[model samples]
Target: IHWHMNISNQINYVAADEKRQIIPYIHVKDMQGRVTEYFAKDSPLTPDQIAKAPRHRMDCVDCHNRPTHIYVPPDLAVDQSLLARRLDATLPFLKQQAVTALTGKYETGDEAMQGIAKTISEFYESKYPEIGKTKQLEIRNAVDELQRIYRSTTFPEMKLDWKTHPNNIGHFYFNGCFRCHDGQHVSPEGKVVRKDCDICHTVLGQQEGAVSMASISGTTFQHPVDLGDLSAVNCSDCHTGGTGP
Candidate 1:
């Protein structure tokens, strides 16, 4: 079975008028002597032109490229830790401090482990003395979790980390889907690949602080920070899998 079947239900089909461009397709003759024209809704390529063009058979790995060897970024790692209660969210500045410690330059794995522990411990000890003293266990647990996260995602010996590899899964930390659907790949007829957010999946709900927003229909994405004209920019332009954007 094809992978598209798995996510077919999630695909939000755009109206005919809203579609900016159609995917490039061609006519091919199979070994069974059947001639099939794999064309899009409004593609303008002639049969002769398409026959002369290159052909690529789509496969799972073409999109799902990083099934293993996954490197989680510091910010995302910290968020996962907080969600799973591995890191104490009650500790103020825990996310900020953890990411800082992880993103800091270190020569070796041992140095990174030591640096992460020291960074988290010292931050709480100096900034929030009361919490540091009273919640010593929480701080220690957070430090331990952070160190584990650092060890798993980062390898100073090989000079490798999340940033070293591009995980083409989503358009959050890297230009995953946007590489093809960035509204720039135009055909001769001026049709594009279509960069609409709802083309793939629907964002059912979003939460900001105490307020939560939801819709039966998908809602437009809201960036955490107020950066103007996000549509014009790729996510990877700003999100560099680091401590700061």
Candidate 2:
């Protein structure tokens, strides 16, 4: 980002390892307040505007989260909910096709499935007219069908040992806990590089008797125990631990 990691090009990493770059699409904000359709479609991010804050910082969690990115900022991935809604509008039968495709395969005799597939392809071509050699759009087609499965709230059995400790107890956004939290923030590179608390926060001692609305001070909520408290819960919070928070 313009703030950390790649700051002013002065901080060169001495870890002696390789690095990757974040390919960004600079989005331009239209300040002219034009209302006409012709002008709206044409406004785009100019090369200069994109170069305003040129920097590269990589967080392994961003790229590997499959289809869903947890630790990434909004600038990275496309909004799934919004895409589903848009795709739903054009093809009303998307939900049924999705259910059939996911729960079971679509019948070769089905006309609806065939029709939906053709229209959906054309729809993607219309929206992302410039989608190039990358197979991203093709993948999106598969995901759109899966999104129907998610939106329908239908999933196969997922067994959980309810007696296990709480690893993640947190609210979910676009997905049910199971859909997103199938894997913890752990990545394969995690074996080589550990994600310590310092990467994101400084979890100070708990402030005892502090008001719910009060901010955390250095000294408050002092549990009369050592650093490794018995009820450490192993993790600070969890988002998708089978049966949620």
Question: For residues 108-162, what per-residue lDDT tens digits would candidate 1 score against the true structure?
Answer: 9999989999999999899999998999999999989988998899999998998
Model 2 has an lDDT value of 0.31
Per-residue C-alpha lDDT of model 2 across residues 58-173, encoded as one tens digit per residue: 23322232342222211111234336453333333334333333333223324334543554454446654554224455536555554443323322232212112221222122
Between which residue pairs do clashes occur in model 1?
none
Clashing pairs in 2: 168-238, 169-238, 206-220, 206-221, 207-220, 207-221, 208-220, 208-221
lDDT, model 1, position 9: 22
Alpha-carbon lDDT, every model: 0.72, 0.31
In model 2, which regions exceed 4 Å deviation? 1-4, 9-239
| Per-prediction CA RMSD (Å) | 8.1, 21.3
lDDT of 2 at 6: 33
